[model samples]
Target: MIRRRPPAPLQDAALVAVSLIDVSAHFDAGEPLRMACAVASAFSLLLRRRLPLLTFLLTLPTVLFSDAVIASLVALFTLASLSRHRTLLAVCAMAFTLSDMTSLPSPNLDLAQTATLITLGYTAATAAAPVFLGQLVQTRRDLSLRLAEISEVRDHEQLLTAQAVLAKERAQLAREMHDVVSHQVSLIAVRAGALQVGTADADAKEAAATIRRLSVQTLDELRHMVSVLRASGGRPTELTPQPSLADLQQLVSGSGIEAKLMTDLPHDLPPTLQRAVYRTVQEALTNVRKHAPGATASLHIRHEGDAVRVTVTNTAPTRPALPLPSAHHGLVGLRQRAALLGGTITSGPTPDGGYELCLELPAEGTA
Candidate 1:
C-alpha cells in the first residue's frame, strides 16, 4: 500500500506544538530569559521548510541555555533534508552537538572523565540521528522522482515502437497491393474490355462489359486502400515532414553534440534517399549523446559514381556514460529503412574507441 504525505501546514503546526511542549517541559516562568528563548525556538519551527538555517540558529539559543533540544534537533533535520552541502550539514550537526552538551551553567568538557566522555558521546549520537534520517529522506525523494521520469519515458518509447511497427506493416501491405494485386486487376479489366469490343453475341458483350465495370470498381477501391496505407502514421510522429539534405544543418545544430556536416550530393535525389540520409545522421548523433557522452561528431555525405554515401563519425567519449534506458531499436530502424531503400547500413567502433555509422544507397532509390 502507498502512503501519502501529510499536508504542509498540518505538519508544520504539529512540529510547532511538539516544540512548544518540549520547551514548556524544560523551562519555568522563574527564568524569564530561558523561557523567552524556548518560546522563540518553538515558534521558529514555522520557518523550518523555507529558512531551515535561520530556524536552526534561532533554536540554538534554547539548546545552549536550556535542556529543551527537540526544537533544535528538528531544525537540524530540516536543514539536512533541504541542503545539499555536506560540509554545511556537518558543521550544523556539530553545532547542535556542542550546544546540547553545554546547556549547563558550568559545562563539563574534560574528555578524560568517563562521565564527560559518555555525555559527549550521547549528545553526538542524538545530533547525528536526525541528520542521518533527514539525509535518508532526501535520497528517497530524489530516487522517487527519477523512477517516475524513467517510467514515463519507458511508456512513451513503447507507444512509439508500436506506432512504428504499425506504420511499417501498412506500408509493406500497400506496396504489395499496388505492385501485384493492382497490376493483375488492371490486366483483367483490359482483357474484359477487349472481349466486349470483339464479341459478336449481345449476351456475351453485355457479360464482358459487366465484368469490366466490376473490375474497374474493384481497382478504384484498391487504389484508395493503397493510398490510405501509404499515408498511415502521418498523424503520428514516425514520418511527418519529409526531411531532405537542406534539413541536415538544422538537425546537426540541435543534436547537442559538437558536430560538423559536409555534403556535396546532387540536389535531384529522391525523397526516399534524402529522408534516409537525414535519419542516419540524426540517429548517429543521438547515439553519440546517449552512449558516447561528451563525444564530438562529424557527418559527411557525398555522391560517388552511382551511389550516395553518408558517414557519421564521433570521437572517444570523455567520461563513462550512465546506464540510460534503451530498447536498441534505433539501429534496427536504420537497417530496416536502408533495406527498404535498397541501401546498406554499417556501424562499428572506430580505432580510437570512437563510433561510426555509414550508409550507402543507390543513386536511383527503390522507393
Candidate 2:
C-alpha cells in the first residue's frame, strides 16, 4: 500500500495555531518575556521544511524559557526526516540538552537531581521518536524499489527462455528437411537428367528436362532455408556464402532466359542495401525461369537523388512451360524487407503482356 505524505503548509499552520494559544495563555499569566519567545519560536516552524537544521537550532533555546514546545518538536521531526547524517543529528541533540539545562539557577540537591533526570528524559524522547520513525520510512521505501527491479528481471528471463525453445525446434525441423527431403529431390533430379540425355522420343526428353530443372531449383531454395534456420541462435553457423552485387553476372549467366543488367551503382554500398539488391535480383530471375521459361528479362539499378532504385521486367514466355512448384511468398518477404528500411516496392502486369517489379530504397545508413 502507498502512504500519502502530509501537506507541509497544513502541518505548519496547525503548529502555529497551537503555539499562538500557548503564548496567549502565558501572556495572561503575566509572563511577557515567555510570550515574546513563544511567538518567535512558533513562527519559526514555517521555515522547517526549507531549512530544517537551522530552524531546529534556532528554536532550541526558546524551549527553556517559553511554553511553546510544539515548534521545537516539529523542528526536530523535520530535521530527522530531511537529513540522513546521524553524527550531525547527535551533535544537535547534545547541544539542545546542554543549552536548556545550563540556564537554571542554583537550587537544593535532591530537587536539582530530579529536575535534571526529567529534563534529560523528555529531551531524549523528543529526539529519538522522530529519528527512529524517519529511518523506518526510508528503509521501507528502499525495499519496495528493490522488489520492483527484481520482478522486471524475472519477467525478462522468462521471455528469453521461451524464445530459445522456439528457435531450437525451428533448427531441428530445418535439419530434417535438409538431410532427408533434399537428398531425395537430388536423386530424382539425377535420374531425370540421365533420362533427358539418353531417351529417343522428343516428348519424353522434354518432360524429363523440365523435371530436372524444377528439381534443381527446389533443392537450391531448400538449402537456403536450412542455412537461415541454423543461423538463428547466439553462436554463428557456417552457412552458405552471402551473395553481393559483384556476383550479378554469375547469377544471370546460365539461367536459361535472356537476362541483361543496366546499372550506374557505386562500388561502396552499405552492406544491408547491397544484400537486399542482390537477393531481389536473384529472386526475380528465379521467378522468370519458373513461370516464363523463355522470357527476355532486363534488370536496371540506378542511383537517383538520395535513393537507389532497382527495376526488373520480363516479357511473356515465348514457349509452352511446365507448372513449377512455388509457395509464392518470395515477393511478400521482399516487400517486408523494403518496408523495414522505410522503402517501397510495387509489382504488377505491364501493358505489353509482361511483368515488372520496382524497388526504391534510401541510400543512407538504413541498417
Candidate 3:
C-alpha cells in the first residue's frame, strides 16, 4: 500500500502558515522590527525551491533577532536536496547553528553555564536533521535511475539470446529439409519425366507431364526453404563469443550446396540492426534457391561510411528456371522494415550471369 504526497503548492502553503504561527508565538506586540523580520522570513520560504540560498538569507534575520526558525530550516533543506556541493552545505549549516545560538540585542556569551551548553547542543542537532534527510532523498532517487538502466540492458540481452536459440533450431531444420525432403522430391520428378517419355497414349502422356511439372515445382520451393533455414546465427555456439560469419562455412556447407559468406563487418553492431540483416539474407537466399537451382551463392557484409551493407549474389542456374506463382511479399516486408529503420534494400541481376541482393542499414540503428 502507498500514500501519495500532497502537491507542491499545497505543501508550500502549509509550511508558510506554520512559520507564521511560530513567528506570532515568539514576537511581542511592541517590537515592530522583530515582527517584520519574522513575517518576511515566513514569506521567503516560497522562493526556497528556485532560489534556496536567497530564501535562506531572508530567513536568517528571523533566526538572529527572534525565536522563529522554521522558514530558515526549510530553506536549508531545499538547498541541500538540490545542490551537490558538500562544502557549501557545511558552511550554511555552520552559519545557521551560530545564528540560532547567539541571542542578539544583549548576546548570551556565558557558555560556561550548563543551560547555555544544552541550548548550543539543541540548536546544532536541529540544523543537522534537515541536511541528512535531504541527502538521503537524493541518494534514493539516483539509485532508482541506475536500476532502471540495468533492467533495460538485461531485457535486450534476453531478446538476443532468444534469437540465437531460434537460429540454431532453424539450421537443424534446414539440414533435414535439404537431405530428406529435397531428395524424395527430386526422385519423384525424375520418375515422372521417364514415364512421360515412355507413355504411348495421349491422355497418359499429359498426366505424366503434369506430375513431373508439379514435382519439379515442389523441389524448387524446398530449395528456397533450405536456404531460409540456413539464415540461423551462422551456427551460434555460445553467447559468450560474438557470433557472425565465423561459423558461416558450416552454414554454407550445411545447406548441402555451394555457398560462401564473406564479411569484414564489426562485431558491435546493434542487435536489432543485426536481426534485420539476418532477415534480409533469408529472403535473398530464398530467391536464389527458388529461381536459380544449382547456382553458387556468396554473401558480403561490410561497413560503408556510416552504414552496414550486406550483399548476396548467386551464379546463374544450371537448369532452366520453371515459372512459379509469387506475390513477392517477403521482399516487400524487408523493404518496409528497412524504411522504418532509416535504411534501404536493393536487388538486381548481376552482369556475371548471377542475381545480386543488397541491404543497407544505418550503423547507428536509429529510426
The alpha-carbon RMSD values of the candidates against the true structure, listed in the order shown, are 20.6, 13.6, 12.7
lDDT: the better of candidates 2 and 3: 3
State the displacement of the C-alpha of residue 138, model 1, in Å, after optimal TM-score superposition.
0.9
* TM value for model 3: 0.59
How many clashes show up per model?
0, 0, 0
User: Over the stretch 1-367, how does candidate 2's per-residue lDDT look in tens digits?
Assistant: 9898679688789887887776676563566666677788889888988999888876876767654566676677778777889888777766665544554333222425777788777867766776677667767767888999999999999999988876766665564454346545655665576678779999999999999998979987886786677666332221244556787787677455688999888868876677678767877876776666568999999999899999999999765554444445467656766776778899988888789999999999532
Which pairs, if any, clash in model 3?
none
Question: Candidate order by lDDT, highest to lowest?
Answer: 1, 3, 2
| Residue-level error in angstroms, candidate 1, position 165 | 1.7
Per-model TM-score, in order, reads 0.60, 0.47, 0.59
Number of clashes found in candidate 2 = 0
Task: Give one digit per residue, the lDDT tens place, for model 1 in 1-367.
Answer: 9899899999999999998888878768788989898998899899999999999999998999898989999999999898999899889889888887785677767778899889888999999898999999999999999999999999999999998889877876665554346545655665576677779999999999998888878877886787788777322223445667888898788666689899998667888788778878877776776678668998889988888999999999987653333335457657877887779999999999999899999897421
Q: Which ten residues in a row have the lowest lDDT in candidate 2?
A: 233-242
Pick the lDDT winner.
1
- Judge candidate 1 at residue 191 and give its lDDT: 56
**Structure candidate 1, residue pairs in collision:** none
lDDT of 2: 0.72
User: Model 3 over residues 251-321: C-alpha lDDT tens digits?
Assistant: 45555346788887765677657656766765576566567867889889888788989998999888755
